[model samples]
Target: MPYVVTRSCCADASCVLACPVNCIHPAPGEPGFGTAEMLYVDPRTCVDCGACTTACPVDALKPHTKLGEGELPFLELNAGYYRRNPHADRTPMYVVPRRRSVPEGELSVAVVGAGPAGMFAADELLRHPGVSVTVHDRLPTPYGLARAGVAPDHQDTKQVTRLFGAIESQPGFRYRLGVEVGTDLTHADLLAEHHAVLYAVGAATDRRLGIEGEDLRGSVSATDFVGWYNGHPDRAHDDHPLDTERAVVIGNGNVALDVARILTADPGTLARTDISDRALAALRAGRVREVVLLGRRGPAQAAFTVPELLALSALKDVDVLVEGWPDGLDPDTSEKTRLLADLAARTPAGGRRRIVLRFLTSPVRLTGDTSVRALEITPTELYEDEDGTVRARPTGGDTQTLETGLVLRSVGYRARPVPGLPFDEASATVPHEHGRVGPGVYVAGWIKRGPTGFIGTNKTCAQETVASLLDDFAAGRLTGPARVVRTRTQALDLDAWRAIDRAERAAGEAQGRPRVKFTDAESLLGAARAARTART
Candidate 1:
């Protein structure tokens, strides 16, 4: 049987390079590679060599025969790509690029984030001889979003951190966790000791609804909700209201679906995962029974990816329903449309909890005296732009009110302005040319690209940034001392972070969980300090 790419594919494209048959569609330079939801395998060309299985960090590749009932859709999804976009030439194998060599002297670089992008950039730089990397993050723990942003139930996706752990183990890799770039160490401070500084800080803020009553007590951003449940230090103490029978999410992207799924998921199932204690406890006691995901656009233009939709559809003991589905939406329009049509056609299983996918609805205003009581929304009409982009325009008729205690704004994420770097406010990103901001200054990941693409997407993004930095270094454009730099901030080193990691894992093992996280900075720091004291 041919190997099939499953839902967990991270789009890192490692399997594309490993495949001897060169069957994977949308390789790095190929069309649609950048925007592809997940990499698909061309079943006709796959040789069943099993190389991709080993190359995939998340184990997303599996034989077609071994697919479970829920995973059988991916086989067609993989084969369907070829039906739509067939490759005429498949003879040439993908060649690995030659490793570039740097100057003879030691090259010290500082990466100003511990996210996937920063880690990937550091890994790429360390490929050259005489190069050293010091990663700095404001948080005490490393793996920014990979540790805190990913949904707790999706542990397979989190496995990418193991690959990051290997990168951390590489010689010359160093960490200065809990040190903020602009506050703790100035950009000039980093440049003074390192040959170049690469900023991979991700998008930190969520886009606002800009509607009236948005500041109501029960209203919150999905970003905070995700972080709260995932144990992000910034949102660990956040208390989201869950006393209502229904909660409404304002967007239909994967994050929206994630929040909806988590809200309606079985608390017992979440207990086995690494969800924060506070969130788990709240969920167990909460009365939320239904989550309504509101999409401004129709099913054809829904923002949630197919993989995420499939996962949400497969939720055990959860009834997935579609509301406000347009009258003439053709099920044959796309895979997403087809899946949504199937969902709309399903008979309600009378599951314990429910998730409603409501389309073509735009929130007009939040209604309440002190807290959110109802959401007023208007129907939208879809139209295609000159650039072939689908957009929704509100129709000023028959506005409906949804009664709910909680409202989550899940429009999207925006990159915050870095203190010392130039930023583009309109785009919410750092202005750059091929990841180059200025001489010896560079950027990578969401901060550079404006919060787009998947976790593995950062691999290629970091590679491009590192390439530009290396080019500048090779041409004598970069100027900095090779000496070590010291900071007064009491940052957590690699050993300190490892100590906290061990403590979390040991605690989780006792409770039959993956890892029980320390939700707050105080607890994390205490754990690290306790570990150090024990060693002493």
Candidate 2:
């Protein structure tokens, strides 16, 4: 009856930190833990305390008896991580790295957007012992993308926020959720109050394919799709566009794999994870099977991490196909290459869910009338430069058509500028060095740097930002914003957060489930406000 790892797990390894007996594998900070799909509960060692369940934001963990029928496969997936080595104790939860310290009254700072970058920056800054931090966000819930943007099956990744939650409850840090700085308050106001403001707003939108049939009913940006399924208040109420039999994803990155895995996963399997009820219902009725993922370059040039490729290829019933490996490169048996080759080798001998990995091919057009009915593509050629970088160009008169109903654009994410700050549209980042963008302005996260790197990469980045901020504090450079603090929320708050958490758990209990999330913001905020009044 051990709960299994479903398709949506992003290996953040939070459960490893929460588990009392340390039953979870690839613990946080472990080598492979960062890339793992989800944390697994060791059935033999699990005392079934359910501590991990409460700690999970996406609700990926469950008691063995609590797993729904479709999630039964995960039990095996969780157990499989230990197959090769019985004593592989990687992924241990490590200590927070050395924290930066500053003078008492000089330690005040304002950080916009409660996403991973903001949270990590705050976590690093709190090490100063006396610094007080005010974290601002547009949504009622904290832990920005960690709670809203990550895929639903990545419950363990979401669990990292339990650490954030613990941080939220910390004495010096103040989370002002549902407050947008530019709107509710201004940069001037924050500067008046604190020494500096760090904008960690993240890359909130998707890069368009900019081709035909992009706005069609079936086509969806994996960004929007992931947001909708993971209960982003903005998209939670909107109808999902993923009603199709065949899906074409135009990138080979991790996000593309997430969409492909979700599209090909068993609806029953998804129901067990924290996938939105609306998405689950749509999936139950949708026609998606084969998702053809297109890559503009060859395997070596791929932007996706080696592990994500393996995770996508390793699904039970789904088969992954790689069209071309680099011409002269001898394939190594490294886990990623081996898994990728296995994916290529397992493609149905010719038929499966058909995650066709096409290299050096660019989308010429998406052919369809009312909605997408097919796609037009042109074959591309690649040449290596003296720098060893491969470049791709289309071959003339080599156009082909692939009949499909859905197209997903999974190019990289572009970080957005904080509304009031100076933005370099080309870079989408607030210009900064060592965290100081201006006299009282600074930035962090995807907005500070374009969307790149893994979660751990942010720590060093955040540390660097804090170091610069501290240096400015020592120099008496950063000033406070213009306005005074006005504490009024436009929407959700902590009491409301409690109510939302309660409602989700209550729903899970009513249906003999673990915990079910509220898909829309209205319900969450409404419940949150009600809870606030009740507490008062």
Candidate 3:
């Protein structure tokens, strides 16, 4: 049997390098590796050496027979990607040689976020065998979205963090938890202590609904909505005030589908998953029915992926209605008609939550006094300019008001300017040339690029940033350390983190789950410190 790559696979493709027998195809240097949704392991060539499992940064690789219920879909998913192309080229396995000599100059570096991007950057730097890394995060927990943003049913994807845990466990790496770079310590201060600073703080903020009544009670941003349901440390105990029966979601992305699915999912079915206690409680009490996902353009302009669309269409007992396609939409849509056809046909009749795809419509204004009452929608036309740019034009044909209680804006993600850093407000990112944003400072993740690509995309981004920082250090651009340790910041080392991980796993097993996260700064720190006493 072949090893399976789980759902939470962030598309890092680190396993391709680790597999000794060259079983995994499209290695990082290949043309398809960058854009491919996830890596594929060739079952025919596998010697079952288990090296891929050991080298995986986020424990995505699992022996075929050991696959759990949630992981079974990935086996088919990985294999299916390969069926489209025959005779795909394969290469020798990647080997990281141990370096005997160390680079001279200020080699210590600091990474502000410990997400996949930061960890991958650190992992790449560690390959140098000299760079000392100190990772910092605002939350008590380290991995940003891997532990928070990803859905709970995506446990296999979450496993990638275990590989990150192993990298963090390596010597010369330090984790400073509960630390906000700009708030807790100044950029200049971090620069003084380390040769350079790489800001890997992923886009934690959400884009907004520019329409009126956006501040109403039921209005939510998909960023916060994802965090709330996924047990983010900040929202673990918070009450979700979703009193709306009818919901309207703005935008058409994977996150938009996630919010709709969770809101429409059966609370009893979700109880078995690792949903936050607070979100689960709110879901149990909520009486939501119809969920309308609004897209301003036609079906050909949807931002959602084909697989994600298929997943949403396959949802059990969910009524999915498409406004434009009911009369038989064109099969070859600039908008992926194949995905649209799947969505139109697969919905179960008389489903509990109705998913209405409202296309050719734009939100002009929001309605209601206390909570959102309805949306004022105007008909729009997809305009293709001479240069092939798509624009939305008002058709002046129909205007409708949609009655709803909740409005979620999933337009996109925006990168926030770290205070005191030079921010390009228009792009919502730091201006940089090959990861070198400025002297003594660098950027990674969404802050480097404008909320583009999956979690693993950050690895190359982080590598670019670290490489620049290392280049500056070698050139004698950085100064010596100062007596400015960010006091409020507390980072847990690998040893302390392992203790916390064990405790959480044990706690989760007791509750008949894989692992129950601590979900807060106090509890995580308490859990980590508890390990010291118990070990003593």
Which of candidates 1 and 3 reaches a greater lDDT?
A: 1
Q: What's the TM for model 1?
A: 0.97
- TM-score per candidate, chains pooled: 0.97, 0.79, 0.87
Tell me the whole-model lDDT of each prediction, alpha carbons only.
0.89, 0.71, 0.75
Question: lDDT, candidate 1, residue 404?
Answer: 96
What's model 1's lDDT at 492? 88
Model 1 C-alpha lDDT per residue in residues 1-536, reported as the tens digit of each score: 48888884668778888988889878877888767888988988888889998998777888998987778888888899889998877874677675886554467788999999999999998888779899999999999899999899989889989999999998889999999877777888898888889999999899999999999999999999999999999998999888899999999999999899899988999999999999999999999999999999999888889989888877768999998777787799999999999999988878478999999999999999999999999999888999999999998889999999999999999999988888899999999999999878999999999878888889889888999998898788999765566776888888889889999999999999989999877889998897678779
* lDDT (10s digit) by residue, model 3, range 389-476: 8777788877789887778899998888887688898889988878887867888888888887777877767667767776776677
lDDT of 2 at 92: 37
Candidate 1: what lDDT?
0.89
- Candidate that beats the other on TM-score, 2 or 3, i.e. the better one: 3
All-Cα superposition RMSD per candidate:
1.6, 6.3, 3.6
Error of 1 at 290 (Å): 0.9
Candidates, ranked, lDDT: 1, 3, 2
Candidate 1: misplaced stretches above 4 Å? Answer: 103-105, 482-484, 530-536
| lDDT score, candidate 3, position 393 | 76
Alpha carbon lDDT of residue 131, candidate 2?
83
